[model samples]
Target: MNNSVWNVTSNSNLDTLALSHSTVDFASHGSTAGTFATLNVENLSGNSTFIMRADVVGEGNGV
Candidate 1:
């Protein structure tokens, strides 16, 4: 059986709510055969009073 894999290509945007449509950018890369990555809301933006969340999904397969 093949293992499930997930990775973060980039955050690239942390859509802010209080700043009238602002965003922050982040980036990461990794490898996995049966693992996943997660970026916390706190890591989204350096600015206080800003919030971010993600339900993103990624996949990988063997050749």
Candidate 2:
């Protein structure tokens, strides 16, 4: 689990911002078989442009 915050103050606009996650795993069986992941962002001013991108890579071992 992780938590992060960013504060920016500039006359010009931001070109790009990136977030990444690698090798997230889930239990094979039992009560922990399923998991939940979430990402939350708050813009106090509520007046900004945002572009989000996600990539998921899966590898199964016949579980």
Candidate 3:
């Protein structure tokens, strides 16, 4: 499986509540046998909050 990932960060500290959103899309070449996907977050510190909402909309054998 091929992996394509990205990361985003803020230069300065956030004093107020910050709203952020991210979207990741994965595609399996021509052959669509069995595929696995995952998402991970690392190094969370200070008075920070992390909320992840995933909305998967697709049409295929396994979506």
Clashing pairs in 2: none
Where is model 2 poorest over a 10-residue stretch in terms of lDDT? 21-30
Q: Please identify model 2 stretches exceeding 4 Å from their true place.
A: 1-43, 56-63
Across 8-51, the per-residue lDDT of candidate 1 in tens digits comes to 45433334323223332222243343333444443332333323
RMSD per candidate (Å) reads 14.4, 14.2, 12.5
lDDT of 2 by residue, 16-58 (tens): 3343322222221223322333333342223233322233446
- What number of clashing residue pairs does each candidate have, in the order they appear? 0, 0, 0
Give the per-residue lDDT digits (tens) of candidate 3, residues 35-55: 434434343333333333334
Best by TM-score: 3
- For model 3, the stretches where C-alpha displacement exceeds 4 angstroms are 1-22, 28-31, 42-63
